[model samples]
Structures are given as C-alpha cells and as structure tokens.
Target: MVPGFGQNKKAVELYKKAVDALGNRQMPQALDLFHQAVERDTGYTEAYVKLGQVYEFMRQPDQAFQIYQRAIGQQPDNPVTSLAYQSVSAYLLKKGNYQSAIPYIERYQQRFTPNSLQWKKVDRLLQTARFGAQAVQNPLAVRPQPLAATVQAFPSQYFPVLTADEQTLVYTVLKPEGDEDLMVSTQKGETWSPPVSISPQINTVNNEGTPTLSADGRTLVFTACQGRTGYGSCDLYISHKTGDTWSDPKNLGPTINTRSWESQPALSADGRRLYFVSDRNGGVGRRDIWCSELGDDGEWKTPYNLKSINTPFDEASPFIHANGLSLFFASEGHMGMGGYDLFVADSTSSGWSNPQNLGYPINTSDDQAALFVSANGARAYYSQEQSASDGKQRSKLYVFELPEPLRQKVRPVSYLKGMVADARTKKPLNATIELIDLATNKLVTRVQSDPQTGQYTAVLPTGGEYALYVVGPGYLFKSLSFDFTKKHEGEGLTMSVPLEPIKPTEGGAPAKETLNNIFFETGRYDLADKSRTELDRLVKFLEVNPDVKIEVSGHTDNQGGVANNLDLSKKRAQAVVDYLAKAGVAPARIKSAGYGETRPVAPNTSEENRKLNRRIEWKIL
Candidate 1:
C-alpha cells in the first residue's frame, strides 16, 4: 500500500510539472503532461489555466475565456484572476460585444491604476464599448448583420468583397494546415453558398490574401509573397474570371509594383484606375497609397505616389467608394487612438485631402483592416477577431452600422465639382486651389486645375469647415467656403466659381511676376500672421529665380480710407518683403508699394466686387 501511494504522488508531481510547462508555451511536452495531470487531479486550477492558455495560443479565445472565468471564480481576488478577466474582456471587445465586455473592463479598472498603461488600454476599450452600445441603441443607425450561415468555420478568414450588385462574395481563407487561398461564394437569394476554392493556378506554394473583386466579378486582385516574378517581397497580382474558369494569375507589372512591397489593390467603380499600397519611393511614410490609371488604349499609366494624403507611417487597404468622392484606407501615420485605424478623405479638385479618423468603436487600438461601406453609406464591413456562436475566439469578418449623421456626410462620391474659370468669359483657367482647415487654418491640400480644361476635383475630408481659395496669375483670387460640418450622407454638392481678371493698376501684368500670393483677412495689420505659408512659397520661388526682382504691391477696396488702406497695403507688402528677406531672399531684390481703391480689379458695384478690390500683386521688373 505504501509503494502504491508513493507511485500516485509521483504521478501527481509529474502532472503538475506538465501543467507548468504548458503555461510556458512548451506545447508538445505540456500536451503530454496535461493528459497525465488531469488523470491524476481533475480539479487543479493551475492545470486549467495552463490548458486554457494553450488553447488561447491556438486562437481559441472562447475556451481560454471560459477556463479563465472558472479559474477567477475559484480564486476571485488573485492578481492572476484579474489578468484572466482582462484577457476575456479584450477578446469580447474585439468580438464587438461592447455590452458584454463592460463588466469585466469595469472590474479591472476598479482594481487597477487608472493611469497605468494597462488602465489606459482598458479606458480606450471602455470608450469603444460605450460607443458600440450607443450605436445599437439608435434606431436610425443601420446595424450591420452577418449574412445567415454563409461564412465557413475556417481557422482564419477575412477581407470580404462583393460583386457590384452585391450578389457574389469572395474572401481570403487560411486553413489550419494549408496556405491562405482565395475563396468565392455565390449569393442565391439571401443566402451565400459554401465557398469554393479558387483555381489552383492562383494558389501556389506562396501566401495570398486580401482579395478584391471587380464590379462584374470578372477581375480579381490580391497580394502574393515570394512569387516567381514580382517587383518586391510581396506584390499585387490580378486574375480574370473567364466563363466558369480563372485565368493564370498575372503580375500587375513594374508600373504597379516596385522594389518594396505593394499589396491591397482596390479598383474604382468604373475600373479606370487601381488604388493600392506600396513602400516605394516618394512616399511620406513607410507605406503610401498609390494609383495607376488605365489609359484609353488599355494600358496602365505609371504609378504615382499619393503625396498629399499619405504620411510617414503606413497607409494600406484602400477602399474606393462607388461614389468616387470618398477613399477609405487604413493608416498608422495620422493621429489616432492606436495601431492602424480606418480613415476616409474626399476627392476634390485638388488631390486627396487630409484623412479623417473613422473614430471610436469602428476603430480601436488594435489593427483594423479592409473596410467596405455600403452604397447608402449606412453600414460598413471590416475584418476583426470575433467570438463565434459556439463561443470560440477567431478572426472573422464583421459589419457595423454607421451613425445616421455620419452616414449622411459620408457620400460614396458626393464631391464639390467646379471649374476655376475666367470670371469675365466663364472660360476654364488653370489655377491653384488650396483647401485649408478652418479650425487649424492648416493648408490640407494644394490642387492645380487642368490647364487644358480648367476643371479640378479635390478630396474633402469629413467634418470641419474648409476655406477654398483659387489663385492664378492674371486672375483675381477667388475664395469659397465649404461647410462639411453639416453635410448629409449621399449628398454631393457642386460649386462653380469664376475668377475676375486682375486690373492693370493692381500692379499691371508683368511676366513672371509674383502675385501678392499673400493671403489675409480684411482690416487687419501685423501681416495677418497666417500669411507665412504663401510667403514661404514665394520665398522658394524667388530662391529658384535668383535673377528675378519683384515689387510686392498691396491694394485695398474703397471701403477703407485711402490713407489707411494705403498704409495697410504698404505694411502688408512690406511684411512679405520682410519675410522673404528673413528667409534669405536678398533684401535688395524685393520692394514694397501700396495702391488703395485706385487699383480696384472689379467694378465697385457690390460687396463682392469690393471684397475683390482689396488685393495684392507682385510684379517682376
């Protein structure tokens, strides 16, 4: 009997050893020991924690969460118990169970330091949870629902794209033992059929992901790594769906791919252009969104960097709304809660504008990728880790309803379309248009209307008031204000502005003259302060033309007295001269002069003309 007891004790000790090994991520050995330990002591808490941890490592968050809850109940006050609770809360939050996660998050916060990093993470989680809960409460919100039983129970699957009519679905799937592959399902009425593996020609030994289907579902674009012929480590490839068969995958060529990785290709609704991500040259950050337009001859134009919009971090996973005005992409460069967040910017006459963060519940500290907004702008679909109906945690696709107010303002292609025309003839004119954020007065984008067509389109970021200024040589500067703060979803607005010709007396047309190019508000002196940006532009231009001498002339409308107007204009011109001199432009190369109402460019017929009368010009003499 003594010998038998000793053998039982040794078995228990071996079981305990196995459980500890499992906790440390010793998978095979832990598996052997867990089997032995459970046989010896069926109720060991440490053994359960270890077992749950292994399952969690295997991407089974539900099992891990359940075991963690059990361990917490067994030892509610332990620090490890709090950790277990945090794990479950994080998993649930990722699963979009904002309400379900609240209790765990609140409990963790109540027991931990609010200022600690851990607490801060919990705070962000709570904020998103609250937002999600509110989203569910609003009747106007278009809550997104998963298509019934259409998704397969694969180890991992994400990045869903639909055909133009929303009748077909294609996505990426990763099996437990196989490489990631593209899979497609057809929509028969309301239900999507089980996904069928794509053609074997496209699924090589390498990895492929983030598939984008064309409107007709005839073209497919995706990312592939370590391919036979690619410009980078991972490059984008396209395959055509031809009558019940897929053609061999073909590389997008050097025009779209570079020495650096390029992936996540999204085609415009018209299929005339391709938007994708790359870390090639001329990017402001690690990865930038670049586009290649398809020419009429059926060839692709060289890829160009999206300079105005991309930052120094990473920008990826672009989704061009059918409306053509909105371009949604993921970025890490812009200010956000954390990691990669979804951002959208409008396309205007200028290029793309500064992007706006999608905010809160739709975006969290964790990585958010591949967003698709419905045509109505009411609902958005994205890939996220979620809890299954069977209570297992896995990376799955989710859809959420955007707030009504947000949806109204996020148009698929609602844009401010207009031509910078000659005010007198209504003839299109090439000019520079600057979109400035009213809140920060920061220049968001600088666009040049077509010299041939005088037409331009710019991207308008969501929210905020913007000041749009159109400037060009020989034309009176035009200013327009856009109040997107109140813009409704799906509403596209158009504004056609006419620019008046600058009168001869306003400084007279001098070849290569630097037009006052200075921007300011009326009745203000001290340079209007914000005049530095244009001044800097002038400084750079002057630096490039060392032999050029410019006269900075300031003029005013008839509203102000001649003396005051003259003095203000002179001071303003002197301010520009002063700035250039300070910026190393030779002081002798610059001169200042002022002409009040005597140089009015427009007839003093109305307030609008009077506003135009007050101006500035630079003459190269």
Candidate 2:
C-alpha cells in the first residue's frame, strides 16, 4: 500500500475520487473531495497528504503546512505521518519562521538514520534556520532611501530597469484603470521628471510588466498575457524603439514560451541572452530561472535551466548585470533568511556558480525581489513593504549605496548619452549611431535617435576606447571617440551630433563637412589602415551619385610652424584623394587643398580643441 492508503472503504473511495479529479486538473473539486475524505475519517492520512500536495501545487504553502501539522499530531513516529516534520520545516523556513521550524526540523532529522533523506535535509535546513535567527536578531545597518515622486508617485511603481548612467528609469505600474503598464522617467540633477508611458502600441488592453532594456536602450523585452498573441498564460514579448515611438509588441514565440507560465524577462546588455522565470518542464523547481541565447538567425534558442542557481522551489526576479558576468535573483528553494531572499551568482565557463545569499540586512524575513544594481556597482535599488504610521502597509521603491563587502567582483561602467540633429536647421533627425571597439575594430552595437527629441543612450563597460559614429542617408557621417580607461565619478558622459546634408552636385551652395574618421600618424601624412572603412564609405557615396564632385581639405592644430603644417596638411589631403582615385573614384570628380591651423572650429587653448582643429573635410562641388 502507498504511504497514505487507508483500510476504511468509504474514506478510500473518496480519496480515490479526489486523486482522479487531481489527475484531470480539476483543482477546486479535488481540493473539496480531499477535505471531505479526511473529515469523514480522521485517520485518513492519505487524504491529508493528498490535500497538502494539492495545496503545494496551488502554491499555498501555509495551508499545506497546517494540514501536515495535523498529520504529525496523530502519528508523529510513523514515517508517513512524520512527513509533516519536513514539510512544515520547509514551509516555515521559506518565510524565515526559523524558531518554529527548528523544532520540527530537529524532530524530522531524529526519525531517520545517517545519510537518509531526513539526515540530508537536516544540514541545509539547520544552517538556514540558525542564520535566519541570527539575522533577525541583528539586521544590517544599511536602510533603503525611497525614490522621489517622479518614479514612485501615487500609481505605485516596481520592477525598475535603468541605463548605466542611472539617469533613465523604466518600471511597471498599475494604472488607475487596473491594467499594468510600463512607464519611463528621466532624471535632471537629483530630481526625476514625471513618468510617461512609452507608447500605446506597447501597452495594450491586456497587462504588460517586468520590462528590461538593452544596453543601448533600443530594444525592450517584457511580459504580456491574454490579448490574442501568446503561447502561455503569460509569455515574454519584445519591442524595438525607432525614433520616438515603440513598435507593436511581438511574442517571443514557442522556443521561449510553453504551455507553462513565463514572465519577468531580464535581457543581457550585449543583446545576446535572456533570463526569466518559468514553471516550465525539466526544471529543478516548480518555478525556476531559465536562460536562452540569441540564435544565429536572430531568434531565441532553446532555454537552458540555470542549473546551479535554482533549487526544488520557486526562483523569481532575475537581474543580469550589464558587465555580462553576474546574476541576481530571488529564491525560496535555497537556504535563506526567509521568503524569496535575494541571491547572486557569478557566471562561469561551465554555467552559473552556486548562488550566494546576499545575507542579513539586504535580505529580511519578509520577501524581497526585483533587485537592480547600478552600473557603477556602487548603488542598489529594490522595493519593499513597510508599515506606515497609520498601521497600514505600503510598498516603496528605494536606493542605497552598496556596503563594501557586497561590492566585490562588480565592475563599474560608463553611460554615453547624446542627441543627433540636422547641422543647419537643428531639427531632430532619425540616425543610426554605432559604437565600435577601437582595439578590436568590432562594431559593438547600433542605436537609433528619437525623431521627436534627437536623443539616444548607450551603456559601455569601462576600460576601453570606443568610437561613436553616426550615419544617415544623404547626410555627412559624424564620428567621435571616448577613452574610459580611468573611471569617472558622477553619472556619465554626454554629447550631441549634427549631420550636414550632402549638397546636390549642381547645387547653389556647396555642402562641406570634416571627415572625423580619417586617421594619420603623428608627423607623417600617410593614412592609417583603420581609415579604410571611412574611405570605402566615401567611395560608395560617390559611386551612387555619379555626377557629384567633391573637394578634400586637411587642417592641422597650431602646434607646428604654419608653413610646415600647411605642407603636411596638403600631403594628408592628397593621400585621401589618391585613395579615393585608386578605389575607383574618377580623378576629375575630386580636388584637394590644405588650410593649416587656419579655420578653427574651437579655440586651441586645450588638447581637445587642438584635436578638433586638425581634420580632413569633403565639400560637394
């Protein structure tokens, strides 16, 4: 007979009927029958265990715990009845009910011999219970400071995602109409502006929540349910921002979503991997953190269980840091102070390492999730419920500096934000901005500017040189570089770009712009190999417009003698002209000139200004 089987015929019949209902997924009926079976025969252990199983399946741990307590009260020494000891211990420990759990766990461990199931759980539960008691006794000194009205005013905000600069914030809020929506706000100095929904195309009649942004803030991934396009009760969805508007949300498709539930997506900064929560099959738990990488075809690959990071319980609220190596999540499966303690795991070549509990103050007996660490790794943000002076509980969003011990292994980053506009009219222009790794000559990411605001933002992991290039159709491309080897304090760097319209070949006015991509040696006028990409672009532009003629000019800073500078500048300009000619541009279509330290865009008082004064320009003729 099975552990809970009974001798009473009527009770056994009722238990069998309930099991049938459970098998058919009729939850409410099964729950009622199980309760009836136990009430009809107080000794129906099978009925009680089945009732607990149903409660567990429904994620009602407290109800299951109470039922198990009754089972143990009747026959504490029966291995079947003794299940209450372990079940109650697990349920209590999940909420950091340590003192109450310690007695039950100790009793459970006593019933089994060395190395048995009870013996194995003894260590893990005992450790967590002891720690939970100690943590409750002494809390961490760090307290969370609430966010301003800009992000947390009235509507109630949570699930926050931010750019590396910490200036832009996106979060989920329950609208007055009862639907959940994602809202955004930007900071001005210490204060943040009121939040506004990104676009109606994204927020729909159904709910959308738990939004994550890519490093460049161009791609957004979130969760949606119940509005026609979904593979599960809730499935992950994605949207792309172009100019000032967001495209309609598209389901991430079957590979990422199953008949099982999925939600709370956390996208990687590199835009290659995704982390989220699911009750999908083959997990170590009822709910687990899972990840999928972007495939070669631009679709998400099959999700891989975050093996070491998940346990045989629920794991939620995953946040993958922009540096690409660390992950933070909340779990009830692992040993912790209490319900859903925030934990972090470091990524390795094999997979994620075993999670480490964030410990005491950062985690409390109460549940904590939705953790976000700033790019600099100096500050952290999360939401928690606190009782007001009026004795009612309210959820608040808070930020605080990281304590020293918690800051290890996190590398700071830089946020590069800017605007792209027309050179003459100064109107916002939709443009593509590309970030290139100077050392590797690889394109890191490409982002678009807002059509209404001419704005863009990108997060950069510090310790490298990057070239920022902006391009648009029928406009001269712009390029600039940032050196972030040394860390900068405050928020991050910002810049603005203006693209000059390419002049018509037979125009009334000539269109001229300095070629910022051209590079030459310190003294020699020979072009660097890296200058080929830009030269190739020039060749293509001329090829597309066959009748367009252009003039190339070179200028130098005031460091050298005027005569020598002029001589060197002329050679550099001529070298570019020669490259264009060899690359198939007709010689008749182009001319070269040198204006040594003469036409200055900025004063030569600083090194940056001096660098700006030295350039090569192409003017339409």
- The root-mean-square deviation over C-alpha atoms between each candidate and the true structure, in angstroms, is 13.0, 7.3
Looking at candidate 1, what is the lDDT of residue 111?
A: 75
| lDDT accuracy of residue 325 in candidate 2 | 73
Q: What are the lDDT scores of the predictions, listed in order? A: 0.71, 0.81
- What tens digits encode model 2's per-residue C-alpha lDDT throughout 1-621? 253544577777888889999999999999998888888898877678779888988888889998888878877777776656778888887676788888888888887697887588686777788889877777655767889866776445688888767777888887666788888888899898988886888887778889998876768999987885788899998888876678887888999999999998998875678999999999999999999988757889999998788888899989988777779999988778866788888888787787887878888677887799887788898877767687755566789887766777566666677888888778888887777776677776656677778888766667776777787777877767667767543246788888888863454466787777788988789998878767776897788878788999999999879999999889999999999999989999999999988888899999999989989988987
lDDT of 1 by residue, 87-129 (tens): 8777776676768888887877777676998787677667766
TM-score: model 1 vs. ground truth: 0.46
Number of the predicted model whose lDDT against the real structure is largest: 2
Assess the local accuracy of residue 621 in candidate 1 as a C-alpha lDDT between 0 and 100: 64
Task: Find the candidate with the highest TM-score and give its number.
Answer: 2
